[model samples]
Target: MADIPAEGLPPADYAALCDFLRARTGLSFTEAKRYFVDRRIAARMAAVGVATLRDYLNVLRFQASGEELQRLVNLMTVNETYFFREKYQLDCLVRSVLDELARNRRPGSRLRIWSAGCATGEEPYSIAIMLLEQWSRVDEYEIEILASDIDSAVLERAREGIYDERALQGLPAHLRSKYFQPVRGALAADGARWRIIEELRESVDFSLVNIADPRQVQAFRGIDVIFCRNLLIYFDDLGRREAAGMFYDALAPNGFICLGHSESMSRMSSLFVPRRFPDAILYQKPAEGGAS
Candidate 1:
């Protein structure tokens, strides 16, 4: 988080930059947030040796390789998440959501779960590990787990599936042993690293996605459960509405949506009704209505 002096970025340049980012990623910054965006952009500009916001915008717009835009997106998006984060919701998914889906699923149909805005793969891998733990005869059921993030760098690291001990802190010891093996490095105990076992690693498919893109988000169809934690809090009103609609469209009838504990669809859309479980609360797309 570099701190750029507000006086450096001209108003016109800031507006153009905002419009560009909004069109591409559906994220918006307010007047108060202008400084945040400016600071981050200034950091990128410094990295590229471009002194002015206008010049950087030109590079982002006209660059042939499109690499600059990717770098900008990587910088702007937040990827803070850990293994077994918001454990109560995950417990609800395993205890209630999966059981309901399993009962209704037709023979040989794969149970599909999507981890939208899955940063560094921890969320989806956590889900996979949970499913394996909950379902003893896991091979008897078909499963499809898709994890996506806006940041390509984090996605690559997630694919590598290596993490320090801190990331595994929330995981139970027995489950950790079963699913992960030590990395080659023999560092200090707290700093020691481990890799997710090949079985769990292969079980998930990771991809680059901008959830704000309607066409791209609609590709997720027939999904039974979606873990979209901590994703929508960044969007403005319009972006939130669009994302809510897209989620509704992507879900199957009666599908469950588990958002971040702090996030709510209460004011955004009526398509998803709130459902309360003992451990957590979640939203579900209506079983009867056409997606709004």
Candidate 2:
């Protein structure tokens, strides 16, 4: 808020900054987001003691350590997520998607599920809980749950697996009691904080991943189901297409991808086939030896 130009970021400078972010992180911002962007940049500049927007840009571009850039990124990325944010998708996953995928796998085969934009550890942890509580054959297979995000700060918080009451709002009382226990000590008496039980926490693996980066996404392969809900909406068309291609490559034949309820793969790419179920519609990659 301090030391910003009286007129705010010059249009040219704003455009340049937006272009830089889109190139590096696949986040697209229009004029509508100018205020949000301006505020974040101004805050970061103040933190780093850069008095001018041009000087901040130079730091982002030429800084050898890349620490400031990471800090800027940490501030800009959104991390508004909570446990079971969309319960229908999880119901669809356990009730239909997993059942369909398991039909093709033998007992003891590995099944990998990814939470592509997991924030604060809730989404993937929700998935793990669903499988353990609802799926009958969960123990028959080797299950791997991987949750990732681009924001290092959120990833660190997610790895800690602690949540306050608000983050657990979507969870029912029974499920909360079953899976999470109150944090110890005097301050926890009000039940303001809860830590996921060690067993459930250890079941999920958290990592820092930028879904927009082709090189970073290459490490994820043979994933059976990908829960990328609510994330692609932030990307520009080109970024969305690139991400779709990367996901297609990472999935095994006949693997599936789940987007937010409002997101439609049909609008972005023709590579996935939309499959309808009672609870939700999911996009699936073409099976091996089948038409794409």
Candidate 3:
């Protein structure tokens, strides 16, 4: 098979591919993203020995195994994240949200927090560390930190719980020393790679999830809090609304949802009430019998 030209797919093919991707993953792409998309598709095409863009699209649409589509999805999804990337939100989790939730729960009740779009485990791992360090009653309740992402490759890395210095830049030196141990024989001139302590690693449950899919999202219910920051910008307006609605349903009454700093839940859904704290503004579902 001939190689795809450096110029990339034709306009019609590009549009078709974009539409297909949006329908399947809820990720919106404009002409500006064509270069990014084309580069990845070209790589997949070369791997599968499919030269033309149209044939590649056909493979994605009709391939019986669906393995190629999964590969493409893995490639297209971005997994840029770091420990303590958004410290304010974590502060809100410990200082405000958990206190309010605990007020309504029994002493030994379960507390569930979901980190949707958790890439490479940093966000959830950060959540665990914050809970340990800041939450006064961390040991009182049974806390579950569920981290999920659409990218299987990143999920594998998340489960491993190993990270380089770049991924830990925002993490404080004190916390770093306490939670991470240097990986043996993985030293570099810059620094040694570190692995999250085994206990912390086991605290977070990582899984593959596509928030756009109602069936997949519905599986999670009665969640106390949700952290879905810095991920919804990829979705179109309708996709955002759909995901927000699913999240609302996933939460228990009066449960909280935290979006990216730049994201506003007000634009996505009216079902949540915005609660402002000094650290951050979080969205909350109305309790049973309360107005939404």
Error of 1 at 28 (Å): 2.4
| C-alpha RMSD of each candidate structure in angstroms | 2.8, 1.9, 1.8
Clashes of 2: 0
Q: How should the candidates be ordered by lDDT, best one leading? A: 3, 2, 1
**C-alpha lDDT of residue 242 in model 1:** 88
* List of clashing residue pairs for candidate 3: none
Candidate 3 global TM-score: 0.95
Q: Write model 2 residue lDDT over 9-87, tens digit each, in one string.
A: 8898899988998998888888888888888998898888888787888998999987887888788778888898888
* Candidate 2: stretches off by over 4 Å: 1-3, 186-191, 289-292
lDDT of 3: 0.90
Off by over 4 Å in 3: 1-5, 186-191, 289-292
Native-vs-model 1 lDDT? Answer: 0.84
Against the true structure, candidate 2 reaches a TM-score of 0.95
lDDT of 1 by residue, 1-292 (tens): 2234557566776788888888888877666777577778888988888766767888998999978988988888878777899988888988887877788766677888999998889999999988878765456578899998888999998998988877899988998889889887454455689899998889899998899988788779998899998888878888888888888888989998998878888867878889898889988988899435
Top-scoring candidate (lDDT): 3
